[model samples]
Target: MIGRWIFIRGQAMGRRGWLALAALFIVALIVLMPLRMILGLTMPETITARSVEGSVWGGRIGDLNAGPLPLGTVDAGLEPLPLLIGRPQFAIARDGFSATIAPSRIIHANGSVQIPDGLGGLPVTSVGLGDFSAAMADGQCTEAQGTLSLTLAALGPLLPDAITVSGQARCEKGALVVPMRGPQGMERLTLKIGGDGRWQADLTLAGLPQETVEALKSSGFDTRPGGIGIGTSGTF
Candidate 1:
């Protein structure tokens, strides 16, 4: 008789625990319904969201876009249990990309960004080098893994006849220095970005052959002591 009573008590406690968990889940859903609705309606002009529905604990954003960049759609949800215990957490995934976002720069993450053809309206494109120098150089390229900023004025010094410069590189950050040699001798084109995210450029031409220097001058470029100066700015 005593053993049977003990077993019955244990089963009852288990039932109570499960019932409590179910109650909390319902409460969480109710509390987060309004917030999820607000986020859906307030989607920023810079971003477009599709099929945004679900409570806080679980939800899906079908597709998203910002300017020329496409973020596709993703499924995401809030994880309040971990957050309540002092660990901020969330989840995201879209086709080939997946990551668990948290504080501390990054943790428990693995993903890759893909550009099938290339980004639009920007300086460098996969198939084209539009708006950049037409200079007939060896067509050098750097890592495509970082941010590149530059002004259009920096590209004009290229020989006008030259067009459609193409090379291979991985994406990356830092100034893009193009090495070109001609009658002006050896020099580099350095494109720098300002803290304000503006593009500026300089021609590091020094000790150029006089014939080449004069040629650049005649091409509508102003000469500094050591190099030719050129540049371009927004909406170029």
Candidate 2:
């Protein structure tokens, strides 16, 4: 009789153990499902910008929560996951207006993977902006205080060695104007940077336009060879 009682008790305990395991498995599934939906998801387009002086200013929707919990609430029932991770793309015309001093068109632009702040509260990845313009205009320019600031690393390998100018350009009263210091003591030169990443400009001592050739000479760019020496500079 004692043996029978012991066997019955053991069976009951085994059943309860299986039930508990199933419940734990269901709970884990419920928790992880929402988490999978939040991370690394593509987001609706967004736009952000910074000034040439390096000030960040833009707005974007943060991580999205899938479960039915109030936004920004970190209670036991809430899951905070990021919906998208990166700076929003913006149209140049929508953000501001610019009159290209020269005829130009942007061909292509892309960026690297953007990671968001994880559960440990680390900062999200820095935003990246990349663009290409042809026959970049030279004219009057005006831009918001903080509309064109980009980091060297974010611009990619080829861009770090190229000169990048981001600001507003406009034609006022039939004259080109830019928000730049008056051309006084600075060496000014018109550079022609091609979309294929080729750099070329007038580089002749005697066979060049008199004004352009003289200007190059004045800037100490006059060298023995009558060809332009193309090289890269470490300023973007």
Candidate 3:
């Protein structure tokens, strides 16, 4: 009879222990669920996020800023599976950019972004980006098309070869120019700041779009056969 009683006691103790553990799990979720708010207070100074909404399990950030650069709005959510492997990852996205950032590196980050160097956020003068601000400000289409795959470097900046462009030219001037040849006759194109922090192109467009040629006139290029040269330096 005593042996049977002990067996029953053991069963009760096991059940009680499980119940306690379940309770703790619930509490932990509650405490950590509002991780977005916590992030605002603790995130690195270079990153500024506002109006954090969502639980620790997942969340959204409105108007996230990296120093003076505005990231607009971004959404980040925790992935459940990574937790099992002793590492946690958050899938983050903002506009044309998306990536999962972890302690070691940024995962599957793919997107394109322009960086500003001059007073008007234009590329530096040394890289020959004179036409960037004017073209962008007028909403003119450069017809540049391409994909952006980003991987975080051990240092803060993006690693070399992180930027890839496919268009009429790999680069021109101080910009990674992507002048897409399209059905509309390649009248437009796109340009982004290159990895060197200078906006210079490695290759100039062989076939210049009429609009691009006109737009770049001030920057010293024209629709002429070779599409004008970039080596010469002057104010247009």
The number of the candidate with the highest lDDT is: 3
Q: Tell me the tens digit of each residue's lDDT in model 1 across 1-236.
A: 99999789767777778798899998876667743464444333444566677765577766644222344677766557775786644465677555443331122323333334332222322222222221111222222222222221222354433212222222124323433233434444444322223444444456656776777677555777667644434311
Task: Provide TM-scores for the models.
Answer: 0.35, 0.19, 0.41
Better of 1 and 2 by lDDT: 1
List runs of model 2 lying over 4 Å from the truth.
1-88, 94-206, 209-215, 227-232
lDDT scores in order? 0.44, 0.28, 0.46
Clashes of each: 13, 11, 17
lDDT of 3 by residue, 137-167 (tens): 1222222223322111111122122222234
Cα deviation of 226 in candidate 2 (Å)? 3.5
Best by TM-score: 3
Residue-level error in angstroms, candidate 2, position 49: 3.5
Off by over 4 Å in 1: 1-35, 38-45, 66-68, 81-90, 100-236
- CA deviation > 4 Å runs, candidate 3: 1-31, 37-46, 65-71, 93-99, 103-105, 109-146, 149-203, 209-217, 220-236
User: If ranked by lDDT, best first, what sequence of candidates would result?
Assistant: 3, 1, 2
Per-prediction CA RMSD (Å): 12.2, 18.2, 13.8
